[model samples]
Target: MAGRILIVDDVATNRIVLKVKLMAACYEVLQASGGADAIASARIDQPDLILLDQMMPDMDGIAVCKKLKEDPETARIPVIIITADNDNTSKINALRAGADECMSKPLDELCLLARVRSLLRARDMSEELRLRDSTARELGFAETPASFTPSATIAMIAATPVTAMAWKTALGNTLHDKVVVIKKEQALSLTKTQNIPDVFVIACNLAKPDEGLRLMSELRSRPETRYSAVVMVIPKDANNKSATALDLGASDLMIEGFEPQEMALRIKTQIRRKIQADRLRETVRDGLRMAVIDPLTGLYNRRYAMPHLARIADHAKTSGRTYAVMVLDIDRFKAINDTHGHTIGDIVLQEVATRIKDNLRSVDMVARIGGEEFLVVMPDTHLDEARMAAERLCHVIDDRPVILAGDKGNIAVSLSIGVAMGGLHVDVRDVGQLLESADKALYCAKSDGRNQVTFSRTAA
Candidate 1:
């Protein structure tokens, strides 16, 4: 069943049409004939989704949406404005008033359903992220970052209470909204499950030289929260303190009493740098569009796939980030290619690429390195986790049969896999040696009649 939906329209006919559509989609529907009633229904029901009309007699949709957003109880609920006005002014006004999306009136059910689905999905993701943040604070892994916006995901701890508050304030300034005030001096309680926050701020001014040194030591000790972009803010007269922070592991430092504009400019520059870093990460994982991918299967070529293996291995050795590589061969891929020609072979490759991507975690990367060979790289995975992940991929491939327009009535394919633990060899040896170990395991699988995963047992 669809989530609860609230329909707010001044016109009876409009409300009727929306209610019928929602009900048909299995949504529990609530109706409001005007803005005041809509607000009341919103408070009473706290519906998952709202369809609000732009024009009303007493208060327009923008006014209603703004008031809804201002109230804590209603802020999380998504509001999609349904209006006759399609001009720029109305759209801007609607969004400014906190409407999540807009759909023009004389609504098409298909269009309405699509936008509603997207908004609801976004709402679910946001809620999950927020819950994860709260869980992090409770676990004591890291202190929550000050809200630059309520949606900012970074969490960090500081030695001094005052600087902790300032870091949060700076973080709050990072967001588009200034609505929420993150609390002060909360201890870090993040768990391993929490995603490493995007920004980490360590205020050197918060502690004396000795205490700050100890604090930095404690922070750098944690495995789960260490990958974040960390900033250390120091007072002007503390050379010893700043040096300790740098030595202990801080990414950037800012002196206290910098000009206001200077600080703002520096903060913006840091934000840009962080954003660029994220983009670079995506490019690296997805394989740069221009360089690595085969035009047919969305898989990486020789130029793209091995570099990640090498880079990941190097990162593991130098930064203590963990990694594992899995080499896979499509069993009897040649028979299908022989029977159906290159056209079907290309389709099978695309299907295999899709299977690999769909089965792996978002943190994992899978790339087709050859016509019938695929590679999976998983970062921060230990032996047990990597083995289980490979087993999962095997099952995913076993269960799904490729669907294609082919000369044969139907066809099915299977995969042979090999997984190597990073610490066993890759973390200590070079990337080429690491891949060789996994390839040895893959060769063993094919030797043993294919369709299984084998883990390397090399001594570190």
Candidate 2:
């Protein structure tokens, strides 16, 4: 199913009509007769979205939307206010009441589907972030997002400077957002600017032969501007253009010669949606970072290293190729910490991590498994190649002394590395046992000398 949608209307005919349309789109639909039933169904079913009727005898759609927004469990479900009122005031009121969209009676099926798909796309993204955040919180890896303030910037682009400036003036007078008139050439540069607009209002066919379509495609292709809300404006007669714009990744669309109040309401809704999307994107990034990274040195930590090693083992076994695992220890690391008071010790660890990372292949994995210990996994490697790689890593650490903070002089450092080979013929198929063999070799290297490489007997 694309998603679950709840339809709330006092009239049975309205519910049936919407349900049929939504079901044709392969969405699971739930019906409610009035506001009371709608609230109850939303609370219990937790649908992905709500198609709400504005005028209900028991309670109005605005009040129901407010109640849903207030409840933590239902707050995230998007609401689209469906009504007979075509006035700008009604649209603005619905937006202010936390509805994501407003559509009047005698709805156009094409426009209705476009809005539904866009809102559901936004909803799916938010739900994914929420699930990842929940897992991260359970693992004590979640980060608190910045407190949101109701501020946004919108850039308007049209065929002529006059039209662009008119839009700026109209939107600026009613909305609190920073509205600017942007040209076609300046559209791509917005990504480089510090104050990137939260939403872009594009006039379709602004340039010759539908140049606005090209601009929208360009913005969507670029990483920085891809997530910004794009609303395309088309002439009243260009119904086909509006649908194409939506399919081409426009978040919303408005007809040409639009009402100022209606434009303001739609733009405001787009801004709100963009802010929420931004928050979700950031939260998901933070969660993933925390799950795999070491806080001290910003390297992959043991929690991530073990599972990665197992994957390498599986690949080597399947391909009948050889792989190597190396355990490296910083020689006399505790002495350095004791002598330098831990602060300098931290600096040394960070520098060592950088050096090792810079010297490895992109396919290799290096992780900090202990205070002074690291695990490096290399796939598709032979015994000689593994030994040379280990030697190279040793030189990377010993060739240059790490400079310290506070004008402290550079300090010499060295490493002891132990390498163990694994493949279809190796006795160690389990990553734990492979690591154990490497550890045994590492102990030999440390015992023989502090700054050399040692290979496990299995390498013979």
Best by TM-score: 2
Kindly report which residue pairs in candidate 2 clash with one another: none
- C-alpha lDDT values of all predictions: 0.66, 0.84
Error of 1 at 40 (Å): 58
What's the alpha carbon RMSD for model 2?
13.1
Candidate 1 lDDT, tens digit per residue, 79-124?
8888897555565566557676565667767646655665565454
Residue 262, candidate 2: how far off, in angstroms? Answer: 3.1
For model 1, what is the alpha-carbon lDDT of residue 145? 43
Q: Candidate 2, residue 430: CA error in Å? A: 25
